[model samples]
Target chain A: MPNINTLWRTYQNLIISAAILLFCAIGFITAVFPAVEKIQSLLSDTQQLTDDTKALTAKLTVLNALDESSLRQQLSAVISAVPTDKSLPTVFSTIEGLAAQSGVSVVSVDIEGDTALATASAAKQTPEEKMLGTRTIPFSATIEGTLDAIQHFIALAPQVRRLLRIRTFAITFPSDAKPVRISLEMDAFYQPSPTSLGKTGAAIVTLSDAEQSVISKVSQLPQVSGADMSLPPPLMGQMKPNPFAP
Target chain B: MSTSEINLLKRSGNTLRTLTDLEDKLRVIAWWSLVALLAAGIILGTAFFYLSSRSDQLQSQSAQLGRQIDAQLVKEGILTSLKQRADVAKNALDAARPWGNLFPILSMIALPTQLKSISIDESAHVRLTMILGSVDDAVTVVTNMIALSGQHTIRAPQLISFVIKADGTVQMGVSFIPTL
Candidate 1:
């Protein structure tokens, strides 16, 4: 450090040094750090806002073009078209009925659901939950029937819940049958599996404390003699966190 | 004795003359040392001035930078808060995209009254926690869930956990693996 005394025998140097130190102290607090943080925050906020605005604007534009109810129906149709449910049994029964009605014999049903794969599939299908891995439970059924029966069953497939998707389908037959003696190998997806009451008390897919307490409490409640399983999961997701709040 | 006395007399006379000259040389050297002192001081002062001038320039530049930084920070802070608000709104809107049919079924769980809360994470997993009004409720809820899951034809087993909370809240995590 250069001493003020060395520079001059005058008081001017002392005043100058004091003023400089004061300026530095003020600048240190008031100007330097805040400026850097502001610049960085500005850039980040810009990017973030841009993304948010894009999403908001997109929603707004959509809302402008279509009514909310119709838009929701459109959205549901798009979402439910994929195999989101794991309850392939319902679909199997539906197909079986169609096959039997058409005079076909029913055979073994097979299932293969890779939740990890479903999650990946959801990522491709939905944009928001890309990081939140999607889950899928897949099942396949092999029904042996006549060509006419298989064709009838396939024709009735459109009546299934929109979530059902035909992953794979094939046909085969025994030598004794006529030219169209057919065995149908159909792979279909159920919507997401229903929340279950298992040996374990868990129903929803969360470890959050709030959910667990509710689960524990509900386990004690008497089942309403009979409640349709299909109607519960969707309601469970929507109820105002409490129904039958004892 | 005679030889020693003679040598002492001769050496003593020469030693006095040499001492006189040496004192004179010492004075001369002492006189020149002042000039060296003055020169040393001048060199040190000049170096001090050069260093101080550089320091002043650097400090000025730093102050300027500090001012600039402060300005940027103000701009960034405003924008960041705005963006965060916008994001929350956007997420709320996104959530509206799902079908309402899925939520009601999940809610029919008939959770015990003692359970204080319900929350759902981004993965559609429901969390139910209760201050155990009674352990029976917990057990009943468990049984129903299992039965329902089977009936529902659930593919991936939902994850369920129960934590014995201090407040008697039996904490549970139910992984509802929704198809979508």
Candidate 2:
């Protein structure tokens, strides 16, 4: 029953107060809540990054303690003994030299092609061989020598620069005084360089004691001379004394 | 007084009473609203303070972690190279079948025996055929060869065949794999 003017006068302050509360609540929801969410997200990211950094630091500490130079030297020596390429001439020369040293006469050297030992060694290829990037090639050599000479040659075969393993041996003793003919079948291995894998950045490596021992043994193999490793100076590039002059 | 004038007076009094009551209710509502606004302000203020403090701490922690990450990255590089080099060396060593122990093993079995021929496969498995003067000599050789299994250099020595010839001579073939 109150007049409109009186009702308006009574509720004006209430309306103003309600409007202010609504504005404040809206401000809190729109501005403050979003900021809190952002801060929470940032904190979570920082915690995760901290954990990752700690793990990386621990790994780095272990890796930093190794003797890098000695490892490189050992690695170099091992790779040289089991070179990546066939280096057939070097292998041929090493076998011929061992034959001469053992006082044996070389009859023929037949370097077995890739297919010769493929059947034998292919089945025996280990998981480690696949991981290390290696393959095997077989070869054979025929020689005539005394029993002592043949024994010495066999003893020294594993010491050569290119890795060799005697697969089969056959001998014929025609007479006690005449030289015995010996047939030797062997396998040689080839490995692609580690760099060939195209891996970049650091990696974790763990070697067993047996693997370490093998590295040490291969490191002891004699270093192949540069002269023995390369083909004789190309005839066209050779420096020779002038035949027409002095 | 006339009846109409009395009714009009009563009606005005009732209207005044209703307005007063409405005014009291409005006062209560206003007080409650003020209290609610004050509580909301305090909550928002506390939230802002807490968020800002946490953000600052996180920023500092992030910076520290970033530095650690950078240092570790450099170390990781060196470690990676060393690991790769070591792996390459190990592979080469594995490929180079160094059977330096073969001779010693053969010498141990050399008792009045004639070693006809010996063969080794790519896996470093050895096969040997020999002739012994007697069954005792053959047994001695077999025992010596079997004893090589104790050495780290050999494994799985198996006597493949043993035949006694009419001339009282024993022929034997043995196969074994090396662990070098």
Candidate 3:
């Protein structure tokens, strides 16, 4: 009976020692490993954020150094040539005026519908379009004039207020030395406002000198005036009385 | 001494030695276990404290950087439209091909040769068919075209053909692709 008691005591001691080791191991796993892993994850995220901040700071510094007014003026000049709206009437009038100046008589003016333009605009808004933001309208005209007048009109078409491309030029001279009948197919481009792009976050960029020169050329193109360029009046229902008005 | 007394002394000495050894072993085991438990506690506490403090510092830094980025973005908003406008303008200009500018080069080359016709395709490839008064004029046309290729405005001016007609006049054909 004494031997049995001694054996039981030894077993208890062994079990107690095992319990102490298990407790230490659990403490290391629950406290030490988790803390270390969290710290590592935090350090990685901090490093990534630091890199992003540095890049953005450098871009901001460069942008701050640029001449804001000059950039605005240049940008305005570019926008002037390619107005936000299509302004079809203005383009038509401008072409007629140019043709008249060149001594060509317009027999017929055909303006195509905006269906193709809508499709192209839709395509441009897609992700596949990437950086393309301009849309073009296609139209045709038939004019009658002398050979010299037709040639002069062709030369003056490019210098008009609205951009024009002479896609197809066909001339027919009558057998009896009558005036020449000329047919022209042209395309004009315009910009859609940035508001159509939804909410695009600010992007920083630098303009090269060559790009500035191109902007200067676009600005030098003649300006167009039409109803599309005008701003809408204040809403009649929402208008309040002006206190300062006489 | 008597034999029985000697034997009894030996037995007591052996038992006393065994008890003393057992007590020493128990003391050593207790000390080691205590030392191990204390070391583990200290290590876990130090690690947790250090890691949490460092994490707090890093989080604070990250917040500061985020605020700075937001401020910069706010400042950049004023120029966003202008930049967008300029980008569209630049793209428009890049898309245009300055085909009229090549006319002068053609005239320059045509005046020396008996130029018949010059036609340009939609892709801006120019085909020139000219009558040369002599073999020397054909050579001059070919050489001048080769030299024109050096200009940045044109690419790959190839002399397609040079043939002598029955009338002894040389007919030369040249094709050129324009780079705008």
Candidate 4:
């Protein structure tokens, strides 16, 4: 057998090559492979961040261009048409105004459905209402007037700013010279305001032409006012510790 | 030198040359592997740094935009709310069956004095009862209705009842769906 030194001299190049290749494999396994993976993950994250930035910037541009006063005015008009809540006073006054303008005498007015005040919790919606994305307050009214006056009231019911849809109406004519009496069932539309806003990166779109036309039509209709249009007086007295005590 | 002696010397030189060639090949391979490993490391490191910096820059930009949008929260809320309600109102308006158009049709068919009573329902069905002066008036109303139906103003017209009252006045009840 050859001595160790002799063996080293004969196989030294092979041994050196093997050792260098082993180092390359170990480096790949421990450092290079992990670094490649981390870089790929970072690339993906950076791409997502870039997209988010672009979206947010676009949203910011839209928000900046909006006219606050004009938006408020339009919003007010829309709210008056399909109010955020059941504006019972507004509805009642609107019916009264319609009666006065049409020269009809109101016999009775009755509201149907759950008359409970709307709470902070979400309102329960029927399947039809959910499908339409609107809640309705149904009411019926009986009025007596001439035939021409009744026709005028029917024509004007759906056009008022406080939007009303006449669901059913019946007019009965008497043989004698008595005024015609008509009973009408109507639906007043009201939708709750959005509970939460969308993400900051979400886009804000402007109204479409059809929507603008609807607003224009409703805005042109006559608006009615109730006597108590003022906001409730602010609490001037000291805050009570036990508000529910009384 | 002798021929056999010359051949042996040449063979010994060839053995040394083969060993040297083997060593050169091994060294070349090791050097190339080292160069490749270093190049991969440098490229990956540079990419990592670039991606990290870009991510940070984008995060800062998003934060700035968020602040700008936050300042107009009220206006944003108002606009969003208005758009939502406007969409609903538009749908409701479109769904409503307008009776205004039906009135003109009725007036054309019969005088208001003759129209004793009328009822309109959600299905766009109109039931009109009229007291006519004569049978000729009733025939004229029916012909006018057929003409209106042909013009697509109404559809499915039916004379529900025709009665001559004791006072000799013709009472007619007509039902039809107006295409409003």
Candidate 5:
């Protein structure tokens, strides 16, 4: 029913429509699909980041608590190491007992200074030995005795069930002093204080949520009460920390 | 009509025919739209799967954070009993200590074994295969029954009834109720 030119034009128009539709389909698959995929991945990443933040925060709380515990332990260790002489009277009496055993008359046994101990902390450097510190308290003693008596006294010092060590000793007799009477000056160090026993050390900072949660759980744990940890020759409730280094 | 006019008319006629031919094929647009819809559904489903999985992970992480925060509160003395230091006396009995198991095991060993039983079920019901050997043994067993519960070491048959067996063995089955 159509002329030859009309028929040709009709074919041309149909081809153009097909070409346009095909292009549109290709564009939707290649360009639009990829873009959508990229957006999905970014959204996934955002969710992951949020999760990471929450987890890290919780972890941080646990770490902080552990850190605080460690610090507290350190403080306790330091307090225990501080030298003290609260048991001086007991030590003197023990010395008297030893002197009686040795047949030595102790004319004088006086503390060189006002010495007192707040705690006794012990740290083992090895299974059998410790690097002991009694510097917080220093003492000087004078005794009148013979060579054998002095030796017995020295031996008796360590044997006192609770340790007392002789750090330094000197034997002196003036030019006009009696030959039978020997004068001795000795320095002894006794057990240190456990000052850190009741102390809380510096706290560590935590910024994570997980750390916070763990700390919270630990806080709820039940603990035994009514156990007294006070040491004899008790320290007046006040603990003055060492002055800050200038 | 003039020669040019005839040519124009022919051209218009051809264009109309072509458009008419394409109209039949254009019906396929509905089919393509269906395919597009299916593709969108699949895309949406995949996205939902990924999002749900991510949400789960985030939830777990949040819970962990909450736990950590709880720990912090404990250390800060927000929890009272936990902050209290264990004393030397009770430290020995604390379940946290490895040596605390000694007392419980000792107590178990001290449990009395007066009731005799042939079998015990997982639910702790006793079945007696043999009865009491003597009237005195029966009374003694009953009196001591208070100490029989919670004793896992007693594996022997218990008394169910006072019936005497053909072989002269006494048989009886008894249950423990005082929860000794």
Candidate 6:
């Protein structure tokens, strides 16, 4: 057996080579691996940021191109058709206006379901209505006139700005010489304003061709109701930090 | 005391030379590996920092544009509302019964007999009461409705009631679904 000095002399080069390899492995594990991992993470984050920037740019471009006045005008027409709330006064006014135009005399108007505005939440949906996902105010009206006037009124009901769908109508002709009495059951549609806007990252969708045509059609509808439906400006004010204290 | 140790066996000349060559090669390989690892670390560090700064710039730009959009939040709300309501209005217009078409048909049907009373609904179902002067008029009414049904103008004609009055006038009540 060799002594320690002899063994060390023989294995010195091999030991130095092994030590270098160990040093490289340690450096790779401690420094290189973490750096590589961080690079990969940063790359992913940068890619996400690039995507967000593109979306925001596109959205800004579209918004800049939009004509606020035109949007407001088109929106006004559409809102007149399907109001955001139950504008009962407009509904009655439209009916009366139609009656006057058709040369018919309005007899009575009755609202169906719960008439109290406070109980709006209690309005129940039928199975069929639930499928349509529509909210409606159902009402019935009676008018008396000549046969021609009655027919004219029926034809004009759905063509006005205050949109009404006639569910059923009955015309009664008296035996003697008298005017015809027409009773109509109808529905007026409304929807509540959206509670929240889309997220900032969401794509802004423009009006589709079909929607454009709808706006065009409604624009041609006679503004019989003439209800003011301008959306109020957003209320902006800061609240006190301690309302109770105040 | 002896300071040096002695080798126990003599090494073969060829084997010792070969071992010396291999050891040299291993030393070269180790040094090069270290250099390559260091270069890789520097390159990765540069790329990481560059990407981090780029990410920050893009994030800042996005936030700026987001603020611009937020400033027009009211317009956004109006646009959204219009989109929603326009869709509803389109559906309503499509689903509305065309009373214009029905009135012309009604006029045609009433041309033969006196249209006393009529009822119509959104589903195109129509109930009508009319006065006929004679039995011939009644036959004419039935045949006319059947012909209209054949032409896809109406469907499933039903005679609900037939009453003969003392004045020799016949009153007829009928129901059918119009194809409008």
Q: A64-172 in candidate 6: lDDT tens per residue? A: 8888889989988888888877888888999998998989999999989666875345667666455545567889999999888888898899999888888898888
DockQ score for model 4? 0.47
lDDT of 2 by residue, B46-153 (tens): 866776676676557556644644444433333343344345555544454545456567777653137766667656778878888889888988878777777654
Clashing pairs in 2: A167-B120, A202-B80, A203-B80
Displacement of residue B6 (Cα, Å) in model 5 is 16
**lDDT tens digits, residues A1-246, model 2?**
567656466667656656666765676677656766766776576666556545544544554565555655555555456554566666677787788778898898887555434233244556655665555556788988876677777777867666666666766545256777778887666553332211212234444576567667776766433323321112221224574675
Candidate 5 residue lDDT tens string, B50-75 = 77677667767666765665445433
Off by over 4 Å in 4: A117-123, A226-246, B1-15
The DockQ-based CAPRI class assigned to model 1 is incorrect
Candidate 3, which segments miss by more than 4 Å at Cα? A1-23, A55-71, A93-108, A115-134, A142-161, A172-181, A194-204, A208-213, A220-246, B1-180
- Worst lDDT run of 10 residues, candidate 6 chain B, spans B1-10
lDDT of 1: 0.41
Stretches of candidate 6 above 4 Å error? A1-12, A119-124, A234-246, B1-15
Find the number of clashing residue pairs for candidate 6.
0
lDDT against the true structure, each candidate: 0.41, 0.62, 0.61, 0.80, 0.43, 0.82
- Between candidates 2 and 3, name the one with more favorable lDDT: 2
User: B99, model 3: CA deviation in Å?
Assistant: 5.3
lDDT (tens digit, per residue) of candidate 6 on B1-180: 333456344789998999899899989989998898889888987898789889889988999999998777777777887888888888677666867567677765665238888898666789989998877777888888888888989888899999888877779999998877
Error of 5 at A92 (Å): 1.9
Judging by lDDT against the true structure, name the best candidate. 6
For residues A166-240, could you state the per-residue lDDT of candidate 1 as single tens digits?
333433333353433333333333223223222111111212354233233323322211212222123212334
Ranking by TM-score: 6, 4, 2, 3, 5, 1
Give the top-scoring candidate (TM-score).
6
lDDT of 5: 0.43
Local lDDT at A130 for model 6: 58
Displacement of residue A29 (Cα, Å) in model 5 is 19
lDDT of 3: 0.61
**Looking at candidate 4, what is the lDDT of residue A174?**
81
Number of the top-ranking candidate, with DockQ as the measure = 6
